[model samples]
Target: MAMGIHKFSKRRGRGARAPMAEINVTPLVDVMLVLLVIFMVTAPLMKAGIPITLPDSRAKPLDQTPKQVTITMNAEGRVFLDDDELSPGELAERVGSLPRGADGAMPLVTLRADKALEYGRVVGVMGELNRAGITAISLVTVAGGAPAETAKKP
Candidate 1:
């Protein structure tokens, strides 16, 4: 009788320990779901930028991000570097004088010209960008910001 009582206690102890070994995944799942929601809400708002009408082009998109110099040309032919106003000659000199990449390559230059600017001004900027040794030039444009989108009756 005594031996049987001891055996029963041991079995109960084993069962209690075994339940502890089962992982509690509920909390982990909850944390992951919260993180997912946070990223989704902030993703679109992060994409909004300085409002400028970009010219349309049929060229395939380039793969440059986080490391390109932006040169903005307003309707009055005023140039800016990420908001710092500069003349075309000053832009070329500043871009040319910057340090090269890790691979000893020239920096990529992106030109963001307003749609109302003259073609000749944009062309001149590109010519200067090339002269500054920035051969990898890309024209920046806002995707799908057409006049038809605003003309809708809502």
Candidate 2:
């Protein structure tokens, strides 16, 4: 009886050690996949900027797409045109020189500004555009709510 029991115990021990030696990789793979998805989703939002709180305004959406010249305003009041890194004076001159289309309509101007920037700087840029004879201007904004229309006083 002792000899028979010893043989049976050895057989069970062999299979038990084999399973322990074989690495269980499923848990490790699951963790790596989860981290990859988290990085992919969050990476873009990280690159945009530090967030800012914007003042509420009621403004109308633009009707049509036109040739756009982008102007950016930083909090310090420095301005940029299409990433050309121009001063306000240069912005006026360059915008004034941009030729009209064959239809004689002025090129559309778009302004992107940090929300922390002063309101006066934005108005100054629009004022410059008006002085440059570019009457059609559009402010680019991310849609957070339903668009609002401002009644213009003629």
Candidate 3:
């Protein structure tokens, strides 16, 4: 009877496996996968969009997005054209090489400059865009809840 009875003695692997001495990562992996799917589903829904009433229209929807160019100026004064880096001196010539719209209109230029940048730097970039024959430039800014008092120069 003693021989028939088995025990997980102190000796390694003599009985039941040592309480897994390691973490059961299967549960952690499952949890992480669930969170990833949840975020993937909800991400687009979280986009900020303005609510507006649209007029009824029988016109067919436009086929393609409007042509526009994005120019970003980082805090370090680096310039990017739709993700391509450009030197300050190359702005005018490179911008001129960009294609115009199918209707022959200049593609709208969106200027994004870091707030900490000097005032003159931003203006200089705008001047380059103007010299490139881009006149429909739009300045992107953070939306304020209400109109604020004007800022004055010291």
Candidate 4:
């Protein structure tokens, strides 16, 4: 009877395997970390603007506007509205079509012009904005005291 009982216990131990109830969270954690890294790298690039060498300014930064429209002009005299290249006329039309804020105020137009661009070109872009009834225009520039070597001279 002892020999038979020993054999039965051995068989039960060998054949009966219990399923794991704990979930493997390592892979899930790994995937989530990868996604976080991707988003962290891309968030700054997602801002609506074109690449340009902004001039330096000693003036204080303006208060954050509730609504904004970004317009960029590169050194080659090409105009861009939120990354979409457009002619002066198209720029006016696009600005005109923008929805107003709750206070019935037009969106503030922020102009970013390359340092190398001719002054006349920047004024011309501003003129276009004015013609479109966009009076609240702001010029973007690097704050003063920044390293001069980092600035790209136009």
Candidate 5:
């Protein structure tokens, strides 16, 4: 009888251990890492710029600067500032209204125009920007024409 009671008490004691209160963070961390990777893969695709066929140029790309404004013109000769459509007058007004930097310098501007646009039309836009006191301008173009060395290689 004594032995039976002792065995029963031991079994009860074995089952009495407090249920594990600690959480396993390993699985949680793995799920978080997977979500982070998924976001990283899709984030860049979300920043799609306005569509336009830029002219070709061999000039090297400019170093992107901070506080820069992008101006885009589609094949229809419509002007867009940072993806928002604006009239010629509105463009000038909005650009001229931008706050100057600490050094009193206007923000750098990048212009991307469709190759199908007329020369005078593009120049007219440039003139508008120049009149707005935005001289620090960069033209966006795609790479065209193989380099002399690469052409000779064939």
Candidate 6:
């Protein structure tokens, strides 16, 4: 009887430990690390502009201008005005409706076309922009691999 009572008390004492008042931060930290890695892996894929391989150019980059408009053309000849897809006719109308700058001049247009597209298709888009009274146009291109000195030698 004495041994039974002692065993019962020992079991009770072992089970009566204080409830945990602190959270386990290890699991939380692990989860947060996983989420951070997922975001890092996906961040580059989340770029906002249209994905197209730009033509390479040796020309220097232009200075940043205020109130500039961007137009993108894909290899399929599809046109987009800042991510909104538009037909050729709709593109012209939308470009025409854009508000003029503070100086009463049309905003500078930046055109980005896929390197695989035909010259005629690019020209057609430019013609639309020109018709919309946008005279200041800049062609967007990726910097070429050739160094300045090497390019100058050609």
Compared with the true structure, what per-residue lDDT tens digits does model 2 show for residues 20-107? 4577899999999999999999986873342333334455555545676777776666777776678547877888998888898777
- Cα lDDT tens digits, model 4, 1-154, are 6555555455555565556799999999999999999999999678645677789887788777668778999889899887789965798888888999888889888898999998998998899899889987889887774645666789
The list of candidate 4 runs beyond 4 A from truth reads 1-15, 56-66, 142-154
The predictions' CA RMSDs to the true structure, in order, are: 7.1, 8.0, 11.9, 6.2, 5.7, 6.4
Tens digits of per-residue lDDT for model 5, 1-154: 6555555455554684447788899999999999999999999667447788777778887776788899899999999999799975788888999988999999889989998999999889998999898886788887664444444554
Worst 10 residues of 1 by lDDT: 12-21
Kindly indicate the candidate among 5 and 6 with the higher TM-score: 5
Tens digits of per-residue lDDT, candidate 1, 55-133, equal 7654666775666677888878888876678864797788788788889987677788989988999999888888888
Per-model CA lDDT versus the true structure: 0.76, 0.72, 0.72, 0.83, 0.84, 0.84
- Show where candidate 6 strays beyond 4 Å: 1-48, 146-154
Better of 1 and 3 by TM-score: 1
lDDT of 3 at 1: 39
> Which residue pairs in candidate 4 have backbone atoms (N, alpha carbon, C) closer than 3 angstroms, thus clashing?
116-154
Query: Considering TM-score, which of the candidate structures 2 and 4 is the better prediction for this target?
Result: 4
Which is the winner by lDDT between candidate 3 and candidate 5?
A: 5
Candidates 2 and 6 compared: the better one by TM-score is: 6
Q: How many backbone clashes does candidate 2 have?
A: 0
In terms of TM-score, the best-performing candidate is 4
Return the lDDT, model 6, position 41.
Answer: 95
Summarize candidate 3's per-residue lDDT along 26-126 as a digit string, tens digits. Answer: 99999999999999999967632322222233334332246877787877788888778897599999999988777888777877777678889989999
After superposition, the stretches of candidate 5 with alpha carbons farther than 4 Å from their true spots are 1-9, 55-64, 142-154
